[model samples]
Target chain A: MKQENRQRLAGAAAGLVNGLFGGGGGTVLLPVLTRELEGRHAFAVCVAAMLPMCAVSAAAGMWNAPPDLWQAAPCLAGGLLGGILGGLTFGRVPVGLLRKAAGAFMVYGGVRYLL
Target chain B: MKEAILTFLCALVAGTLSAWGVGGGTLLLLALTLLLDVEQRQAQTLNLLFFLPAAGAALFFHRRNGELDTAAVRRTAIPGALAALVGAGAAMLLDVDLLRRPFGLFLLYAGGTLLFSRGKGFSNQRGEEAPPTKKTQ
Candidate 1:
């Protein structure tokens, strides 16, 4: 497939996931983007693309959310700091180790959810 | 107070992962739903909202490092945004359990792939193979 077409499909898929799941666009975007662009560029593209997608999805869901959702403000604040930290350390950290840790966490999450 | 602190810590990890472009939302969702005992739909809503700031911060860092691809961002953003609208609508109509099971399965698939995959797919700024791609399946 053409690069343009692949990108479109990937974008659409990522958007859909972001909308449905609230913010997992990167999970869908990473593989497709990796195949379409260079590795680092692909990661950048995923990050760039997710910002808008998350904004739109959050807006769409805002009216439906319960008031209790505000309780998450602390989490959101922490997440902001984490994002800054992650961004600053992006190239400095061992990508492989981070990936492994992320993978382990995902697995733990999955199993926890399943049972 | 303790719960608030825990929430902050979880969000911090999620935010970092989001900045790293590794799907922090998934982790956030898991923490909220499984650990904190939030409802699935509500957890998802918070995850989306939490993403805004996290993504913004990450974008700032990525741009500073010259990692962003302007052309690619332009091409993907609109289409992705539109599709996200459709997805959000669907999620609203779907049952809570229906969303939870698939999300769990997806996490498993994605996590397993990341753990075992060789570090040959992605390249760093130096153009050397850096690590495997971190996308969820």
Candidate 2:
């Protein structure tokens, strides 16, 4: 497929997934984009493109309902800590190891979902 | 090429799963590393970036449906966003390969848990087969 066509299709797919499921589509989308594009740039572009959609989906979830501030505080704090730590720690780690870990996680998650 | 199409298709699936609260980031990482031949760090970083917007949209949708706990957002997102920024910066500096092994392991564990726990009350929604509990009992 042409670049423009591929881009268009990808966008359409992202929108459809976001609209239907809220925010689950990108997990699948990223891999598809990487495989199809055959390059980090394409993968990066796909990730960049989905940013707006992700924001929109999250906003959709938060639009009407208000979380209990107290209850969420810890989670938010933890998420923040986790993000920072994960980001930083990941860098020091071996890429091969991470890939293996990812594969393992998928197997586990897939099994969990299926079973 | 075959590679390009495959990556695009994978992202498409990842996006859908993200909506249901299964973080698309991890899935993206898996796809990139296992299928697309992308570097593990690249995949991990990309996964983080991809998830931001999807997560944002889901939060918005939940808000519209009265599912978002605003108080939670204030406490969690505020901190989480800040941490994400720091994390992103750190991710920029680290060796891409270092994190791949554990990340893979994590996916394995999570996927396994989900599969094994099927038909259980662990999920937020109670299954039909679950026996009814009696307040009277």
**Per-model chain A TM:** 0.83, 0.58
Per-residue alpha-carbon lDDT of model 1 for B1-137, expressed as tens digits? 77778878989988887766566777787788778887777777788778778878888877887777888887788799999999999988887678777777888887876687566664333455444433222
Collision pairs in model 1: none
For candidate 2, give the lDDT of residue B79.
29
- Best TM-score among the predictions, by candidate number: 1
* DockQ, every prediction: 0.59, 0.05
Q: Chain B TM-score for each model?
A: 0.83, 0.69
What tens-digit string does per-residue lDDT give for candidate 1 at A1-115?
A: 7677677788998899889877667777787776656566677778888888888887777777753635568867887899889888775555676677878988998887687
lDDT of 2 by residue, A37-114 (tens): 322222233434555554544443343223334322332333333333333232233233333344456795444433
Q: How many clashing residue pairs appear in each of the predictions shown?
A: 0, 125
> iRMS of candidate 2, one decimal?
18.6
Q: Candidate 2, fnat value?
A: 0.06
Model 2 CA deviation exceeding 4 Å by range: A1-105, A108-115, B118-137
